[model samples]
Target: MTTSTLILPGSPEWLRYFSASKVAALPIKLDERGEYTRGVSRWESPFSLFHRMAGHLEPEDPKDEFTVGHAAELMLAALYRELHPGWRLSPGEVQYVRTDLGVPAMATLDRRASRGSSRRVVEFKTARDANEFGVDGTDEIPADYFIQQTWQMGVTGYTRHPAHLMLGMSFFARRLFEVAFDAEVFAFLLEAARKFNAMLAEGIEPELDDTKPTYETIRELHPDIDGTAVYIEAADAQALLDSEADLDAAKSFAMGRKSWALKQMGNAQYLYVRDPGGDHKKDVKVADRRKNSHGSVSFYVNKKADLAAITGGIS
Candidate 1:
């Protein structure tokens, strides 16, 4: 198969290519026309990739307000141009299809830019707050975004790329992080994609992950219950019961610890952990309690805690 790079993103021709954004229908049915026949695309985040290969339906997009992601998509190119001097930026999406792998794969890069002889694949992202980017005043790219960008680099044959992360709806904070392509990790991702394609061809479903998305997908898969009961292996049934008990115990344990912490907090709005003889200025803030407009109190831990010092690297 020859690589195709001419198809525009979201075009009818592009729809024929496999995309993680497209919802997979349930009952193990695949669209005969497009998705089932095409190769995987870099548009897949790890979560969506797993769901796609597992034959799980993608969740419906929320209909409420315009999302941060939507804003980021619309503004990424313009922002990139404004931030980087002497770089020539392209406006449209750059698509790539690689046919050399065991399973052919494709990707759609958000924008491409060049400075002299240097070229880069650029991706854009948005976060609710700075804490999501990092707690210790550093930008940490999320794993899924890393994988997506790395996949894009692999597909486009770019050695390095930069991901621009925007914080908040107002675009209050912006940070650019560049990533280098990793041959070993990209090889692993390719192998995984190949196996996923195999599973799809063999009509096998991937094992479910313990995630809300998976739970929601399962719920959507069987919306109406038939009056039939299915048999389960005794060990599987026992495991389910054990999991339920474990969840309850974990909840109770967490609640008890929280109650004790709250009691220790007393009338203080913030809780701290300090050295035996340390000054207030040197104290480590642990958690804080705040009252909302509804007259209800909420407690949350400090995101900047040095977990390695606290847990001795156990976690």
Candidate 2:
């Protein structure tokens, strides 16, 4: 079966049911909020989400693009089945309900039961044939897809989690990856969805995202406006200055540390810091120092989190 559109061409019942296709669309009313915005789609931008939540008019995407994308998603689903044997993937049956946040929501899978009876959801994504693989391993999904898959899990009651497959059509290669369910993220999404719906119910407008589209939208909203000046609180001006100063200081501090590290390994392409052990060999920290093709020097540091540590501060 083919995927359904959230804003299907139908009667009022259509508004109550949301499909994955409309995740990016701006929300129109409280009744339609969950169907449009609840799922974790890359379309969930701060600006777009706010507009959707506040029932503001969103910039329209080209009809051609929308149709092409939908077609691509369907084709990818077929390709997935052909590529992976024993996977019972099918278009999801959409169900509309009042979510815990008290807003209408739905989760429709592009293909379900990706890997056996696990009931795992599979999200198919198609990228430009020219785009390079994001991670070193072909099994890793990009950040956006991870969020999308997790969101799918959140709404589908698939606490087992979701798998994502990205297809680069130019090469006809597919990358399969899985994301663990995050309770915190799911809870946050529900709360945020509720808050946005509440804003719509209360007739409150959300702040616009600082983006070109929003700028254009603002211009259109105030088109042919007579010139006028608005007053701001002195505290706002002071806060801006303070923030700039703090950023400048952080930049200088980071630059100094980078330079110092570079100088310490002047002739070497890598630096190894040895932490000597009392009764064993030293534990070494390796950092890469290399020159790019453009003659620009680059440094690599281990930025991964230390799970053993109590705090997020660098160890």
Candidate 3:
């Protein structure tokens, strides 16, 4: 889903991080220590950028990019309105999006202690569509996404579920596919978060533990879970079919549970952070370029794990 590195230019992680925060109307809560935790401080998501260009209604001979983009956005906004009644969004927030993840992280989630309150996180994604662009169709999120979503849950202590995965999607020709939250995926994420947090406390950052059958155990124990994390599927796939609607019908292509595509606006628009040869940027890293870029909020890396490896920033 949003976690995939298949995005146009930036790392898949960077793209998803920024896109979700930008489109979301609500503000992301600061980390436990009050450090800002949102991803990407600039640029609209590819889908969001195009969607805005399409506007409320379609224009004759609309840019295919804008039409498609607008349709996707309109549908999602409408879906959010339907699913989260109290949830709010601010359209202009995209103007100042940032992804500092707070030098080092202000705080990390604690796995052992019981967490209180409902926590939520969102991620965004767009693919080549069913129209065919190599081998791009996927109904499932990459394993990394599960970990990333879970990390948010772990970090924020939302719902006491350990983690939650909110998947959003917009395929070129196919309607958007949205899956609000996958409990199973969250469980895996929670475990990962739990382990990662534990490692952080111990001055370590847990890597994908090949020693354990990571996902298998999670799947087996999923039904036994009862956490409060709330996942709102932003799309109503059935709406498009039953209403005989157009692309304006919002559905989430990102989340697997829902499917929607804006009716083709002739003028769909698409954009990239680097509009025609812009400067390049890199993810927050663990100092020495010789080492892998680990322990960053974008990757839910542990604070103390790579403390020595880090030349700058603090958690």
The lDDT of each candidate is: 0.59, 0.55, 0.32
Model 3 segments more than 4 A misplaced:
1-75, 89-103, 106-118, 130-139, 160-315
Model 2 C-alpha lDDT per residue in residues 62-174, reported as the tens digit of each score: 68765676777776777767766777776643432434536566666666764655666666666642122345234455444555555567777777644555454545665
- For candidate 3, what is the TM-score? 0.25
1 versus 3: better TM-score goes to: 1
Q: Residues 165-271, candidate 3, lDDT per residue (tens digit)?
A: 22235332322222244556445433332333343345541122221233343343355557678654547546645655543343433332211111221222221
Worst 10 residues of 3 by lDDT: 103-112
Question: Which model is ahead, 1 or 2, in terms of lDDT?
Answer: 1
Q: Runs in model 1 with CA error above 4 Å? A: 1-59, 62-66, 73-79, 132-139, 160-171, 233-235, 262-272, 275-285, 288-297, 302-306, 310-315
lDDT of 1 by residue, 1-315 (tens): 223457644444443344223212111222454333222232333344445445455434664443546556667567667778878876766677767766656676666778888778776666543443553223366555656666777667777544333333344456667666788867766666665666566766655544455566667667898899999999999999999999999999989988998999988898877644556655667788888779989877777776455445644
Best by TM-score: 1
Per-residue error for 304 in candidate 3, Å, reads: 38
**What value of lDDT does candidate 3 attain over all alpha carbons?**
0.32
